[model samples]
Target: MMTRLVTDRLMMRRAQSTDLEGFHAVVSDFEVVRMTSSWPWPADRAYTKTRCVPINAAHGMAGPVLCKGEIVGIMGALSMYDDGPELGYMFARAHWGQGFATEMARALLDHVWAQYDWDVIKASAYDDNPASVRVLDKLGFHEVEPTIGTCKARGGDFPLRCFQLPRPPLTRV
Candidate 1:
């Protein structure tokens, strides 16, 4: 089943073929792509299109972050590490400085924790991207370590800050 999450100002659902154009637009921006690890620098439409295809939820959740029916960003919690699913997100440069990243991430993390059986979710940010670091921090992700990570866009290894958020304690009625 496709996962859909709704927040006060954003709605995140499975990616559709129709979203390819918007997805490409966001990834095509060098300022946005440089902060991510997977997307290459010279954004390719073909690769961006491939990303629009939805994957099985058992692997993780991913989709477009829509605001009033327009794609503004992308968010995901993919099993990129052996430890657990990793949280990742990117927003259009126009949407930067807004609270969309934190809002979407909080909703995604909440949904993942409640719907999935994972004990913890992992996340990381390039040391240079203080914006992302702040987002992860605001969401209560604890810093675990500092390591070198490769940025496909930057085309080299850079200082990476790793983080993890454990599932919140259950509350009884």
Candidate 2:
């Protein structure tokens, strides 16, 4: 089964079994995964399938962000508290700085508020990832605080900035 999401400039849909090779190509690139997941490249299908697939599928079976029906990226929330969800995204290196991230972020927010009645959404990025910060800003997310967290990928602690997006009151109490 596949679900589709329409953004101002992109269409997101459920990732299919056929997308694994393409998904792996995008996520395993050094330029794409280096500063993002803290996971180094040449990732195998097992990890991507077992870990990434289940995580992305949890959002009502929605997969990831796509452009023109092609998988360009992935965006979704993690911890949804107080109707505020923790958001995250990753786009192919070729799609960087193309405004796709912002478009997808807005789409995800819209989906959550319209379908899930969410109040707010949160996201975090590495302290040095200005592009991601800019994307969140364009989507109306504001910096809430600095989060010092540990990612198993790096096998150590890391410092990242947390951003939050508050949905309009029309959809939340």
Candidate 3:
């Protein structure tokens, strides 16, 4: 079944076929795609459509972040590394500066921790993107290391800072 997460101001759920136009709008922006490691530059609608497939699997979950029924961003965690699932998110340039990233991420992480047995969740930010770094920090992710990451949009490598949030201690009810 597709997973859905609701926060005070946003609704996140598995991407649906209808979210194409909205998802494209967010992924098409050069400024937004440049910071993403996988999205290609000169955005392709076809590629973006493929990402709209509802994903809820053993490895990860992903979907669109909606506000008042409109898609504003995309967020998810994927098992891209051996240590754990890597958290990733992207928002339209217009949506930056709001606390949506942090809010949505916090909810998703909560769900993941409660539903899964993973011990650590990894994340990364381009060294130059302090905004994303701040989001990760706000989510309580600690810096793990620095490494070079390739951005398909930039078509080159850039300095990336890795981070991880270990599973919170279980509390007896």
Candidate 4:
């Protein structure tokens, strides 16, 4: 995670307090935050300033997703369960459906494969979020299970679809 991950249209670096405004914009929207695992919906600038940065930083995986040097969203991984690292990402509503999420996830996966010896990465999405499931599917993640979980942002339990991607074989020397 030392190097910034990049794609043709996005740049990802560790999230910092300086990105408060952009972070606020993305998480404040109900549509955007509803599907998220941790963010509390109806987020305001005050909450973003007070809470978001520290929470993201603590995860050590949350990074600002930038476009042309401007923050557009956040992407990263965290181990919520004892099994392994769980891949997660969130883009501003304005940037949705342009392949940015898939791009970011792929870049993250590449980085993980190259720099870490982990066997697999896990991810989960609300079963209702077809777009997220599509992104995971496109990256070769297969469904592992289904469970119910609470989304702090939405303040209710929802059906969660879990998926995993095993590390691809490394090249021979």
RMSD (Å) per prediction = 1.9, 3.0, 1.9, 3.0
How good is model 4 by TM-score?
0.87
Two-way lDDT contest, 3 vs 4, winner: 3
Identify the superior model by TM-score, candidate 2 or candidate 4: 4
* Span of ten consecutive residues with least summed lDDT in model 2: 53-62
Instruction: Residues 5-44, candidate 2: write the lDDT tens digits.
Output: 7866788765556777667767776666655554545666
TM-score of each: 0.95, 0.82, 0.94, 0.87
What lDDT is reached at residue 48 by model 4?
A: 72
RMSD in Å for model 3: 1.9
lDDT of each: 0.90, 0.69, 0.89, 0.79
**Shift in Å, residue 136, candidate 4:** 0.3
Candidate 1 lDDT over residue span 24-50, tens digit each: 999989999999988987999998989
What are the per-residue Cα lDDT tens digits for candidate 3 across 1-173?
56789999999997789999999999889999999998998989989989888775676778999999889999997674566688999998888999999999999988888777778889999998999999999999999879999999999999999999888899111
Better candidate by TM-score, 3 or 4 = 3
The prediction achieving the highest lDDT against the true structure is 1
Q: On a 0 to 100 scale, what is the lDDT of residue 105 in model 4?
A: 82
